[model samples]
Target: MNEAWQQALSRVPELLAAHVQISVSALALAMLICLPLAIWAARSPRVAAVTLTIASLIQTIPGLALLALFYPLLLGVSALIGGGISAFGFLPALLALTLYALLPILRNAVTGLTGVDPAAQEAADGLGMTGSQKLYYVEAPLAAPTIMAGIRTAAVWTIGAATLSTTVGQPSLGDLIFAGLQTQNWTLVLAGCLFSAALAISVDLLLGLIERGIRERRRIWAWAGLAMIAAGLLVATLPLMIARDNIVVIGAKGFSEQYILARLIGSRLEEAGYAVRYRDGLGSAVVYQALSEGDVDVYVDYSGTIWTNQMQRSDNLPKAEMLEAIAQWSSHSHGVKMLGALGFENTYAFAVRPEDARAKSLRTLDDLARVSSDFNFGTDVEFLERPEWQMVRDAYPIRFKNARSFSPTFMYPALVSGEVDVISAFSSDGRIAANGLVVLADPKGAVPSYEAILLLAPARAGDQKFVAAINPLIDAITVDNMREANYMVDREGDKKTPRQAARWLNEKLRE
Candidate 1:
């Protein structure tokens, strides 16, 4: 391995540390939020049924959606409290993760607590033990194992779901998995996934040991196991939790695609022994604002998104000029430095089902415009509101009879189902090939060049070694590799993660 890989391995401790905080803090908060409800419900069949119904309802929503659900709630709260307390960052992550963590914990705690012998309860009452005293001395001690089992379930689930926190801009192993997948960097992704697995396994084992101790009351094993887990967490999180030091925060836009690029850069920076924080999943406007306000120090950003969405400039400059002008604007106006472009593009491409495009002669945006009033469109939530669409509409003079937005995850299937005749797909997305869709040409130059660039916080531009180490790696990624990497995940039966995909990218680049 090279120096960067060796160093990346070294910072596994830091990654683990950040991982534990999310898991533990969320678990702790979950216990406070859920345990009481569990106990109260445990006192009666009706209440228990009600409590279970609510907790189980939460479980039905997918982890990523559950996490996204909390953003609005926390955003409202943050608005009330106002001075940079963001729902889009760590708080929503923590809260949503905690909620996702609750069902197993509450369900198990209720089962264990109520499972205690009825005779034991009667005897405690006959002996005049108060309810609190019975709970403390008799019931709780015996129920500890069952409660701990719930905690174990919560622990594993918490870590797994915590990975999705990358969706909401919370950094954890998902950063590696998601970002690594985007660029097909498995080495980096493996580093993330293995550490995450190791953490979950290690935590599970430790909790298992504790549960056994509680069942057996073996004080030595209990104290020893708990102590080791605690000590390990303290050491692991020290660097990331220590935020006052001179650190650069790199951000990614909130999507699977952005997750890949951001994580690759963030993980590499941490490996180089520089401190880094990630602000991911921030809205298009919010990311630039954070960069301007100096909340986040650096991040991976798109050329087209910045041009059309952020700056409202709509010319298709040569790739070099576009990068130069954006970087110049960032530097001159906001003190941000666009380091250099990663050798990949994720521009908006209009696509149609292969059979339909073939049958209809719809090979380009110009073709679509002529028949725009007949075809329907499907796309992600943000794309519908973005200026690129307006520009495309104006330049190509296009319109469709019906248009709808769905999460990127659902768009391809919608097209396949004929629910939409056409959709705006990302150029780098694997779904293009996986689903047999045709990416129509932008023959009239409707869309701008959107090469991916690594933007640094103005102050971070000072580090030459930091800049040198990253530029080479970023410059190596290609659009085709990104498609294959994502296909490993989105394509059926692949089951590979972003990290696995990233490994392939890194290997190919080395070749």
Candidate 2:
């Protein structure tokens, strides 16, 4: 077998663990939520119409957005009740997936409960059985098949949807996919996707067997469900119950810029007496949720990213205005706080190798667009989908006939090798100059600012010692300083160990 397959096989244990939690939790919760509602809906026409309609409507939402939507929503409710609600990671994914899991379960519950034979109901009633007793003893048994089928469907849906949970900072099979995708290793993505699918299929089949056995009056299915779920819960809770201490988890998006910032954060936190852990190479959508959920305590973020991606604000507000708006939004919406800026913006820049640019005379984006049809494009995953790309494309009308994408890792190499002539490089990336790449001028300001800033989880905001201890490092970081930091990992192959990078940065700052 190839090395990719070997790595994929190695992830079986992790994939299995994550799959069990996401599927079981979402299914169990979906059953709990839907069963009662389904029964109630079964009792009346309006109830069935409304509740089922709502559940179905929820199911229609694409998984990722549903997960994203619940982070802030549930966090808001938790905040109103108490001070310790973390909206990120497991909670949001769980809640959204639970909702998604409902349609199958609710529909099944309603069908099962109400589908009982009228003759049986009449006979039970004639025998002087009470409503609860008759329903429990008679209807529940008969409905078991339908109910289990619903659960089977719910389990399948949950397993499939769980892949998206990673976006909310919840770890699962998607970790493999994203990690691999960010590094341009298709083996990783295939491993994650295939494993997750296998998990879902296995679960669906197992549940189907149980449903059949229950329907067929075989006692083994009952024993199996108990065994499977019990085993799953034990495994799922084991990781959490592991001893944790004054551990601070820092996160970063998959790129050079995020690497430097995460390193800086980890370093500062350690110096101030925290045992730091790293959850580096997170996706943009996932990183914020991870922070809100308390999966990650802190990380470096951009004001414009918070403003646009998280808050859905489109205003080209000035730097101060944008930062203030994002800060307020985070506090009220996510129970998170923003530390001030790191004093430099790391915006997107389209660059080509100096040789390639010279040969093509592609100094400006407009000049490059004429030859765009001959070139391929490489950019961060988020940029490929953003409106900024559309705006830039419209302004310049650059039609790269052979457009392609690579993870930030491979982009530099591709550009240098003429595999892709134009790459969406970050301003703070050290690789641009290292590879003698020239950044094209975006005469039209389509892309927004991505100023580096420190974001604090609400739990940490009250600790003045914590805030004051690290606040000084932000302004101390300059563009050149950041570039050098990125170079250590990207070019120097410094293992991308942010903690080490951060300490080196701390010493530099101290000096």
- Model 2 TM-score relative to the real fold: 0.70
Q: List where candidate 2 sits over 4 angstroms from the true fold.
A: 1-19, 72-85, 117-119, 186-191, 194-202, 254-295, 303-345, 352-356, 359-423, 428-436, 441-511
Candidate 2 lDDT by residue in tens digits, 1-511: 9655675566556555765677677888888888878778878979999998998898788888898788668767887998566676667778888899999989988999999999998999999999789878888889989999988888887888888777666768886676665544566678888888887776777777788888999888777866785775687457555676867777777665675567677666677888775564566766887687677878888876777778776556767777788888898987898878888778778998888778777878888888888788877656778766766776788888676776677778888887777888888887887877899987666566788888887788777868877888767877777777767656544344333455566667632
Q: Compare the candidates by TM-score and give the number of the best one.
A: 2
Candidate 2 has its poorest 10 consecutive residues by lDDT at 492-501
Collision count for each candidate, in order: 13, 2
lDDT of 1 by residue, 1-511 (tens): 8643663476566556667888889999999987788778778889889888888998899998888777667657766887466665578789888888888988988898899999998999999999889988777887789989999999999998888887666677776666555444466668888888888899999999999988898988888889988898888788766656767677777566665566566666777887766655566765775676566777777898788766778667887888888988888887888878878898999989888887888898888888889888998888877778877988897878999998777888899999998999999998898888899998777789889888776666777877865776667887888787767766657346444555566666622
Residue-level error in angstroms, candidate 1, position 426: 6.5
Which residue runs does candidate 1 get wrong by more than 4 Å? 1-11, 44-46, 241-244, 254-286, 289-293, 300-364, 368-387, 390-511
Look at candidate 2 and tell me the lDDT of residue 235. Answer: 75
Best by lDDT: 1
